[model samples]
Target: MARRILQASFVRRAALSAGWLAGLHTLAGCAPTLPVVVAPINCPVSAEQLARRCQAPQAIANGATYGEVLQLHQLDRKALRDCAAHDRLLAEMIVQCQRTILDYNDRLVEINRRIADKP
Candidate 1:
């Protein structure tokens, strides 16, 4: 009777060990994931240069236009020139220029999203 009890205890321990190992094996099959990385946007001109150009009217009316701003990936020079030509305050021009920079950045983000969403 003692031998039978020992055998039963051994079998129960083996069954428990097998169950625990099976659970571990199942968990091992599911691997941990890493965060996804995205590429940065490449702009042609710096924000400071764009802001300075926006503050200068002659620079805008002479050659700077919306097309030029878009091509250079800069602020809206024409809008800045219009504001300056209308005798807007220097502070206002700066604000408008900064707003233009934000607009440009938003546009670039949208473009990047569209490109990324392509099938």
Candidate 2:
């Protein structure tokens, strides 16, 4: 009887260990993943730069106005769609453009926050 009890306890411990290992394996499989290749930050121009250029005298002389914002939106949408259809290299350029614009905007937002926080 004593030997049987000892064997049963060992079996229970083995089963528990197996269960724990299986759970860990499952958790490892579900671990969050990050992109292996980070997007490059090689943008020469940004959305703000584009906006400023669009407001320049040449653009204004071409009949640009405040209401031309809609036209800008349409142009941007068309360019994005074209980029989406481009081959891998062009597509990467498009993504880089987007990242650069976003990085610029993030910096602009931080600057605004700091200005607002000034006493």
Which of the numbered candidates is closest to the native, going by highest TM-score? 2
Candidate 1 C-alpha lDDT tens digits along 1-119: 99999999999999999999999989987844333434444444445544553344334356677787565444446666665754445556567767777876787777777667655
Q: In model 1, how large is the Cα lDDT of residue 81?
A: 60
- Candidates' lDDT values, in order? 0.64, 0.65
| Candidate 1 C-alpha error for residue 37, in Å | 23
lDDT of 1 at 43: 42
Query: Residue 32 in candidate 2 has what lDDT?
Result: 53
> Against the true structure, whose lDDT is highest?
2
Which clashing pairs does model 2 show? none
What is residue 43's positional error in candidate 2, in angstroms? 5.3
- Which RMSD does model 1 reach against the true structure? 16.6
RMSD of each: 16.6, 17.9
